[model samples]
Target: MPHDLNRLFPLRPARVHEVCGPSAMSFAAIASARAQGDFLWIREGWQPDTLNPVALSEMADPARLLIARTANQIESLAVAEEALRDGAIPLVVIEVTRPLDLREGRRLQLAAKNGQTTGLCLIPEGMGSNAAETRWHAAPLFDPGGADSTLMRWEIIKNKTGTLGFWDVRWNAAAHRLDVVSPAGE
Candidate 1:
């Protein structure tokens, strides 16, 4: 079995991990379970917050989730960079509608790595190029079994050290664990 997110896809602490596709938010919430500690969500203030508190409560400690608003991508990234370096927060999820330059991207990785924290960068559709250690393109798929479970269909667009594969993500609220279900067709 894959030991860490790196093996699962291309996620690692101290590296910029990009998540895209139609269900990026859902993917982000599910992926966040892999990382522990306080959560940091950085996004534009203008955008509506679609995070479901009850659903998140089933995954991580909902009380630790913090949402920060920024005026632009630069500030959001800058805040993310600083937060990653603190080492206090374990997971920093940045919602970006724009692309980051190489230097800024590198800084995010370095900061996260130096602080031993996980950095999850969520990029919306048509916002920017997928750039990171691993880029996950995901969309929600109706459960074939007609259960209440949510199946997150995803493809590893860019995987540096992991094999390319597709899987359906199912979150078990009771167990609070993420299970990779049968691989779905593209």
Candidate 2:
């Protein structure tokens, strides 16, 4: 039987959570998912020397998680591709400093379709592209904790699968999870 993409995917309740930096929300989104047990993480060859040890430890624990780390962007993408092929990971998140062209985006989309995975590209703020199923522009929310705080508000710029609008989403840095706040019902 052919896989049912629609059944597996839903726009209404937005299963996929994303958090972008000033450049790409990939890291934030991945970090949040890692905290939530969506998929195992593998950081490729781009480990920063100044990474927070505490944060790293929390994200790497295998008992409450299935996250792993690689060494670079290429390796990370490869691992994600393999996971999709094996049906181990249904969602793959990638961060791109530069905006992807239609061809490249189409290729990634096709790959996701074939592997039955969702490819999420984190682009820089104000970076416009017509390739993704949805385009979101996110910004950090006000936090009393200080600059290191992870609270954020996601602005949904464009969503092809559902209504073209935005929603208020909060990321609890303590819980490392996202919660969508509902508007006041009529």
Candidate 3:
């Protein structure tokens, strides 16, 4: 019986861990999930105008992405927890203003593992614990066009999967995709 259960439900790979810095971390996460398929996006204080409509449209077709906006952080987390329990979505990405504590994060992690889903918690700069598979610190990067423009660069601070760190990525808000950029001098 145990062998049958194991065969029916093989263990999943460890979720990717990453720490984002000062760039389009949210967009990057969304884009990545969209490419993979079957993911839910729980946005807190998300502004539609801030996202690139074309990019969002491309990846979110045919029910590839689901967006559920919440009134506050607690509501967002609660909704995420519920979704994880339902086991309907394969990935859940949440945007939060404050980092979750170790205990709460562990609970969420367990739920994700049990549900065979990936839980990505997006928080403000310096708003997460070591408990998360990957803790990302994201901020908007400078846009040569103008301060109001949406082009951004993101940095990856910590990656639990391996020693991968400090990635500078470019985001096209219009396309809602991430690209690797050359160094400043290059």
lDDT of 2 by residue, 102-182 (tens): 665565555666666555555556554565666666665555545754555445566565554444445455675544554
Stretches off by above 4 angstroms in model 3 are 1-22, 33-35, 44-55, 58-62, 138-152, 170-179
Q: Per-residue lDDT of 46-129 in model 3, one digit per residue for the tens?
A: 545344545555435535667788888788878888876667776677766677777777777777767667676666666666
Give the TM-score (vs. native) of candidate 2.
Answer: 0.58
Query: TM-score for every candidate vs. truth?
Result: 0.87, 0.58, 0.65
Question: For model 1, how does the per-residue alpha-carbon lDDT over 31-103 read when each residue is reduced to its tens digit?
Answer: 6776666789998888876788897877777788888899988889889988999889888899987777777
Best by TM-score: 1
Number of colliding residue pairs in model 2: 13
lDDT of 2: 0.48
- lDDT order, best first, reads 1, 3, 2
Predictions in order: lDDT: 0.76, 0.48, 0.56
What's the C-alpha lDDT at position 183 in model 3? 33
Pairing residues by index, what is the TM-score of model 3?
Answer: 0.65
